[model samples]
Target: LEPLAEAGVDAVVLGCTHYPLLRPVIETVGARMFPSGLTLADGAEATAAELATLLTERELRGAGPGGLEMLVTDLPDRFAEVASRFLGEDVEGLAVKQVDL
Candidate 1:
């Protein structure tokens, strides 16, 4: 953050699955570090927003509740645990299929 501030970077992308959890602290530090204001963007939220916009524009919004299906090539046992952690939601009872390819 100090390096970015020194380099005059005015925007920071919260790019990982866990970075959003620290958004408040990051914003406070950014405000103090970057005197000229700063922009903090959550990458996942931005991507989801863009996807929603595209789906709406293309008239592809589904009429029913969306279903989530997780597929993995290996480690079926750990997939759910890892996915739940990464997604920040309880993915219990969700089928995680193991694929050969």
Candidate 2:
């Protein structure tokens, strides 16, 4: 509150997943200085919904024999360490592709 009051911020984001669970506290503080605060779950759900719509519109659903296509903003030096959670060990490398919206 003191920092935001000094800095004159009108909005802020609460990044931790648990922070949103304390929405009341966050909202109260934000209301005192900012217009809004959001949790990770809120953004995640909204993004997931959007991705679902994109998949439906593109007729891209379910895994193919080749499995799910992986795309990245940049290929990390440690691909397996990063990709394991979402893509798993099966995907050895990311075949780079570019898409323009």
Q: Which candidate leads the pack in lDDT?
A: 1
Give the TM-scores of the predictions, in the order they appear: 0.58, 0.39
The residue-by-residue lDDT of candidate 1 on 21-74, one tens digit each, is 778889889889998999988989989999999999999999899988877886
Off by over 4 Å in 2: 33-42, 61-101
Q: Give Cα-based local distance difference scores for all models.
A: 0.86, 0.56
In lDDT terms, how accurate is model 1? 0.86
Across 1-62, the per-residue lDDT of candidate 2 in tens digits comes to 66875676655565544454566776776565654532223565567799989998898966
lDDT of 1 at 32: 91
Candidate 2 structure, TM-score to reference: 0.39
* Poorly placed runs, candidate 1 (over 4 Å): 70-89, 92-101
Model 2 poorest ten-residue lDDT run: 35-44
| Candidate 2 lDDT for residue 95 | 55
Q: How accurate locally is residue 87 in candidate 2, as Cα lDDT from 0 to 100? A: 44
